[model samples]
Target: MTATDGHGLRADAARNYERIVVAAGQAFEEAGSAVTLEEVARRAGVGVATVYRRFRNREQLIRAVFQHIVAAEIEPAMAVETDDPWRDLVSSLEATVEVLAGRKVVLAIARETRALDLESMRRFVATMDRPLRRAAEAGVVRPELVARDLAAVTIMALATVHPRDPGGADRKRYLALLIDGLRPAPTVLPPPSTPDVHGV
Candidate 1:
């Protein structure tokens, strides 16, 4: 079974799983998702069989890597909160943008594998719920804005990130504009084209 499946793995197996994920992250950073499982196995110092045992396919390994990166970089931003929900929301969005923009190879893999990312996106949207709710309650953001809307806002901002510009100047500019749109406003939003799959 995979790392998250069935019972927990034994200590040795758990170490291998972690190694494979870490190695895959490195490989993906260097080579994108097209890197072979054998290459990841080599980087992890594990046999190919071990890699196959933990992840049935390349897609599975990429998903694991995606989850690993999100946990390492994004979840911390999601968890931090202060008395000011608007500030908290803005901080979290900035962190998210920085992480995603800095990892261009990871973003390319994620874009190529979008068909398999609905569940991951659902989990991400769920994490934004508390901040969005608090922002609306505090009258800092429009009540009509939802967690899914924040997800879209992030996507819109990320689209402006320039690969050659390590500082992400354009990303910050567009993100600030999108953040302004979140402020309490008289404009009524059209019904979301896509429903919130995680149900808030």
Candidate 2:
């Protein structure tokens, strides 16, 4: 489905859909992919038929849950303001890490599907290109660096920071080091010598 049929859903149906998605997100986070659809329906105070009607299958429900969480969390962080592009990038990364930490279901989905294929990773990097370019142009991040490099670094840092059992301090320290490394370095130019004298 390209779009939700907002008009078609009765108020009660809409509420049921919303509740199911929310419950699914929480359940998936706590229980990973093994969480049952029946449990989601139970948590939402709705019937199993309602949950299935809204989301045909487990994968669809998982994707919808992810999208719902992203709309709530990451979308807001993208609106942050900072004159320093590097700072903005750091802030955005921090926001992303925080969201991922809170929503283990997203991580579980990624692990289950092995979703970080080249095309998907490329699209992910592309999404950050505009912001990274702005940061680079503003001299906040290294001008020679590209979005792909940043994406790789961020992914690596997240991996180290988010172990099977991660802590808040680990996340903060790793991200801090990553952000520090992303900052632009000062450029150096050699001193000019005086001009040569003309021949007599």
Candidate 3:
């Protein structure tokens, strides 16, 4: 093959790979991670073999899509700034829950990934911590409330709203309830479902 032909083939392959990752992320976000690889290939406008060649199995493709989400969506959201730290923390928490509501791939990553790149988790928690502490000092959440509660509340409030849900109403309704429920109780806070601060 000519050098020009070789360069074109390489470029095309790279494009195909990108297309597949993008398509897979979109599919997972919309339909959850169980959506078939064939559906991903079709949405990407490539043959099924192309997806399989890039990702040997459904699990690998789902992981790649989660990586894409971390890079593309979560990172940008984390960088968002606002003068109101309380608002910032609350909105980001809600957004995260909304983003992950039905995403089984992310949930799987949360449950299974042995060595998750949790740096983002740490930073996100720090961001939430400052505002949360400020709110607590102002008597919003109880003084005893820790940073983990923010993550716990966000996940528990939204995890039930999967892609199979009829609408976002339930998610929004309960998220608001959970947020307001944080008003300082006279007694100690109850134990949360997951102990780790990071939801994903």
Please report the candidate that would top lDDT against the real structure: 1
Candidate 2 per-residue lDDT, tens place, 157-181, comes to: 6666545555677768887887777
Best-fitting candidate, scored by TM-score: 1
- lDDT per model vs. reference: 0.83, 0.69, 0.68
Minimal lDDT window, size 10, model 3: 1-10
For 54-169, candidate 3 gives per-residue lDDT tens digits of: 88976677566656665665556655657664566567667767666646555654346442346545544554566676676666567777776776686678666755576788
Local accuracy of candidate 1 as per-residue lDDT tens digits, 35-147:
99999999999999999988898778877777776777887898898998999999999998888776677767866876237777777777788888888999999888878
What RMSD value applies to candidate 1?
A: 3.3
Clashing residue pairs in candidate 3 are none
Better of 1 and 2 by TM-score: 1
Which residue pairs in model 1 clash with each other? none
